[model samples]
Target: MRTATSIDVVDHDRRRLLRGALAITVAGAAGLLPAYPGVAAGGDAIRPFRVNVPEEDLAELRRRVLATRWPDRETVNDQSQGIPLAKIKPLIAYWGTGYDWRKAEAKLNALPQFMTEIDGVDIHFIHVRSKHPDALPVIITHGWPGSVFENLKVIGPLTDPTAHGGHAEDAFDVIIPSMPGYGFSGKPTDTGWGPDRIARAWAELMKRLGYTRYVAQGGDWGSPVSSAMARLAPAGLLGIHINLPAIVPPEIAAVLAVGGPAPAGLSEKERATFDAFIAAAKMGNRTYAAMMGSRPQTIGYAITDSPAGLAAWMLGHPGFTHWTYDSSDPEKSPDEVLDDVTLYWLTNSAVSSARLYWEYDGGRSPAFAAGEKTAEISLPVAITVFPGESYRAPETWARRAYRNLMYFHEVDKGGHFAAWEQPELFSTELRAAFKPLRAAK
Candidate 1:
């Protein structure tokens, strides 16, 4: 439930930073909470990392497909309306015939995975520590229609900087987590798990790892969650970097449109970057946002039932959601688009994943919309603006939320799935954004 539009800016709950990603417990629904017995991220606390895909789970997925009842295509033939059943049957046939769930399961397992109970639900994440002695700690959060799968391509570059032509100093102990209910994490069976709760979860996650300072990076839903972390000002959350911003405001738009003074502590180039971001948001973010906000589950079933349905649900997005290209002529290659969508389909998370929309709806929280004209984030912030992202968050409006924005960049190519599409560009901006703290640590 929203507190009210005009209430004084609220600070995040002042809770002690917990140790270990999932073990930390917080207030849950009705004041109930989950418990983790004495856990730290290292040594004994580090449980064996593996994702067990029970045979029954796979059997259930196949069983559901076999038992699917066909619906006539004329009943809903339109693409924009929902997934066309006519198109879905063939894909489901392929899923039952050719798709290999074990291989998909293995690909995910190759990366060390961990799950901890953060707040009330289980938080599933991938933690890859760089061999580099000075690796920076960074947390990557995925949004709706996305999961750690979206950022898989970028994990290697982030985890091993030298291999990607970057200094080992830029290496990161990267953390990729499936946001509540999107992947392996526990479903938000109840409400109250919004951006603010997620931010707190990230803060606790970082603290559990013994990271006194680190970078927070995200795109899509990740942007606001990271922003909420900045608002919370956890002791170790030194800086925040986002590929997306919640929304741009009129006050900041006026400044960006008119080309006014840059926000305090931002470079002139950063100021111009904000202006371009402001300009882009008005034209691009509307369609995707409107769709994701409403009737997400209606479309969820379509993606769940058919791989082609899922592909169509996702393929057009990077063109519109990322900064790489316009909807008509997307900058990203079709292979790249298919790859991202494939990760979701191969994981068979389409239906369970879509449940996130239903879960959020039950709570009645609109995490994407920025009802406030200006939201002030107290911690240091950095933002990466990609071409196709719904719309850019200008520095003018950004300043109202983040008091200490350390860096900002207008990336050359990439979109909503920045980590996967342009890992180098994504890592570079992250390195630059968190450089100040890196030096201190």
Candidate 2:
């Protein structure tokens, strides 16, 4: 779920050719769920939204799946070509016959969810409060191909910060919001509202909840959003902690970037780190990011409606991401990955979610840098890198912007979805990283 980096997940030219048709789908409307009033300034504090992703939407997906105009598969290797027909057909059968959206909806309803407008969009987030009187307000952000479901496991550790051997001062009032064009939030009709816009809106949201100051944390897309929150210096944003840092060395931009030459002007540590990141990304979790960046909506039909299609689309994930798939250390089961993807489908938010990538890739998102900024943050920033994530900037590069850097952690077990895969370790690092701020307060 940690997604600041969006590298090509496939061999470039082949991926490029696949976008011709799918690119068109990104522009058109796919999931037209009810839009809450964009201009509402004073609605009820908590507008109840259980996951009743309408039956009309479900029917639409089913119809499309049955009528799916099958694509011809490239021979042999599944790597070069797009999702294979051999895999997709059976998955469709399962989605229609076996996948259960109502059950998922019931589970979501069990959490405390509320919607409030910030910057003309209806922000849907789960605002979970602890029994503890004083809980630190912590907002969780998800990246593309992900939703609020990323941190569903960490809810326990985050809410009950004390029981997890952390201080009562560390207890968090958790807020997990659906990003723009992703889940319940409005698919931005215009371009300007990107991650920074989302971050600013989030800051406003915390203030609306009556907190003068609070902490921010996220991985993947959430990482940048949280970074933007710190960068914006919004009221009460105490400190920001993230899973990954999208690094761009301005001085030697050519040498270290993805397609750049071998890194030059580097210390041994920096060189080793850079090489490791490049190597991992090439070997692990590359395709999904490539497809999303190129033409997210190209295959929207599969993800949005066919439950089986959705599962097959991300079937390699939990194992590819969590250690369990290969058993290195930290891992999660297939059920967990299925649950996250299914949430999007059951709620019929798949295409809308993919649209975020289209808009972001289209240069519409704010948090994603134009080229990469001069690591301009002054507040304390902490980064936790996981195994499946493939890359973690070395301290030398990471320190360029985070001048007041407090912690740099690298764990071996988990992959991209840290909170889901290793909540205990993740929560531990979070409490420790923010300890200075919590102590000050």
Candidate 3:
């Protein structure tokens, strides 16, 4: 275990006593939360935002984590049962005692963060413009169990490519937005905030940002939102790049749905991918998706109330568990994992974020479904298959699924959270993936 780092603490006992008075005033009998300070009173105003988690909230989070009741270790030593108790215990201990949410908060505030209203929800985003001339504008989205924190590492490299072993031409004006119900973004008080709606809001967001031509990228939930934007084919959207592309043929998907063998005529890579998907399904790897899609509110109760429970639940994600969690590996550090889990805890967005699964037609949407048609997407599409991803998307299927396939390459590293796990490699892939689209710009 890595030695715990200390944080400089200022006594906020007085502020804690007056915390209720600092709460935003309710607008009316409907009890609407007040608009953030500096946000204009009217429509389409993009206001600067900063992360300032209350010190008391952090204190209470640590208290909850330390107060957690122990669950007996799983009968098996492996992770087949779930995140093993031994693995989570140390991580939770660090989260309670060693982790500093202020560091993560400071990292976020170091960047250019902003909030804007889109489709009745206040969306939080990080907007960074490259110094290079004619830098291509690209909107990137984060997935479940992740917040904008996932993309933090790649921002500097992508936005300023020259300094990161790439040409100025590779520079990108990056737009990373927190999904409607995730991070600092306002949670939806009603239904209808699915990927399609989120996609439209992203398009509007780019237009409002004055980017007449832009591209998009995503993995996990971001995949569907970006794909939806492709389907929308909004005028400014030049193309899209997805690390997690849904390219399985309907025939193959149907067979897998029933736990059948791989269909015939698949290439070795395709067959391997097919087998992997079948194996994952049998292993109950997607049980989390099923639970969140069906009854997010039910499980939300436990995760929302218990900080340790929340950390364990989020760490159960295949992306986090599969990563090398050694303290020496900065990219896959446990602190980084806790950063994401802590964000969910601080914002009380466990239920709101899970609801995105519910909104995806109980997880039957094309994003989660393997065999959905990709013909509706008239715009150019690019894909990068990371070796550690849940399922390797075969080139054959990718070409077939994306009619106007512009780029497809398999990289040696990274996984479902490719950008988070391998930011430099992920940034390089983006530079190459969107190179062709740059000509259009």
Candidate 4:
């Protein structure tokens, strides 16, 4: 969910190549490929949805990948420059030749997917109702560079706990929705689809689905959405859980914002966390966020055109920096990584997804503002700190942020994409985190 900065140097030749390749593909495919309706015409109806990309589109994607004008290797040996070409080349090569979009598409189609109009945009979600009679409903949100695919691994574990090392009482009815302008969700044509609005739409979506009560969960951008839901205190909403708790205190945030040293009163752990943030900032790891938050459309053009470019662009995410890209690790597998990149490529959501950063208003948005702003959220709040997250949020900051902190625990594993990286552990944390709320439900 955390984005690293874009490539610092703009290769005008690469840009020209990307545009030319895309234009050719679009022109050639026009009037030849059959158009399939992604969302229903107009209605609040929750219409069934399926994945059916035209063969021509896949062919075009391959062509673009093969035609990609890759940039020279980074001047430096390490990732300090950007995603090393050596690391991404083979992956892009495999993506064009061996990677199967159909397999990823099939994985999505296997789920019970649907779309419904929420506010003006059609929201796509995978709704899996647990067989357990007393199952608690929880809506999980995915962050940038992620889709419902990131949560796919945790669905079975959460919704069918009895089959996945948990008791039936721990079962949940899971709702994984694509944020507006991400994945299968319809992109907003106008502004105002920020987290606060998206939070309201989620509440409406949950209500429309007949869930009088539900809990919300999110990480990355989802963190803010879940926070907004908590702040709204919408009727029938039980409580909320977040992996990326916005617990940075305003004083600390202000100091960090100005590149100042940690204040004197910090504990060892808090000081370490503060130092991590400062280090990340110093390394230009946050420049991607700054670019997306300010000029998404400017960078969107390059990613939207070249599939290889898009793949490389997404790989720049800080979440993947420490990930071991092996087939054995389902969470960090190359195929899974490609699945996420291809979704953005196929959906042309690069720009739309980036806009969420722009709308974030540098974390000043009411829903996004953390630390002191969290005091406004009186509802019960639970948090699980993954060891590999951008920074381990100290319990002190969490308590200071949430007025009614109900649960806080740190896991031994997992990173930014917690559920995707460790679905079993992630599900266990959720079951435990929401157990108290289930009683209230």
Q: Which candidate number maximizes TM-score?
A: 3
lDDT of 1 by residue, 179-232 (tens): 875656655545566677888888887776667768788777787677778777
Off by over 4 Å in 3: 1-41, 365-372
Better of 3 and 4 by TM-score: 3
**Tens-digit per-residue lDDT, 124-235, candidate 3:** 8998889999999999999988889999989999998988999999999999999987888877766899888999999888888877889999998899999999999887
Off by over 4 Å in 1: 1-46, 54-96, 251-374, 393-401
Q: What is the model-wide C-alpha lDDT for candidate 2?
A: 0.62
Give the per-residue lDDT digits (tens) of candidate 4, residues 10-96: 222222222322122335544532232322334756666667776777888899988889788889988898899889888888888
Model 4: lowest-lDDT 10 consecutive positions:
1-10
Sort all candidates by TM-score, best to worst. Answer: 3, 4, 2, 1
Per-candidate clashes, comma-separated: 20, 10, 0, 1
Question: Scored by CA lDDT, what does every candidate get?
Answer: 0.60, 0.62, 0.82, 0.82
The C-alpha local distance difference test score for the whole of candidate 4 amounts to: 0.82
Give per-residue CA lDDT, model 2, range 222-241, as digits (tens). 87788878778787788888
Which lDDT value does model 1 have at 89? 58
- Global local distance difference test of model 1: 0.60
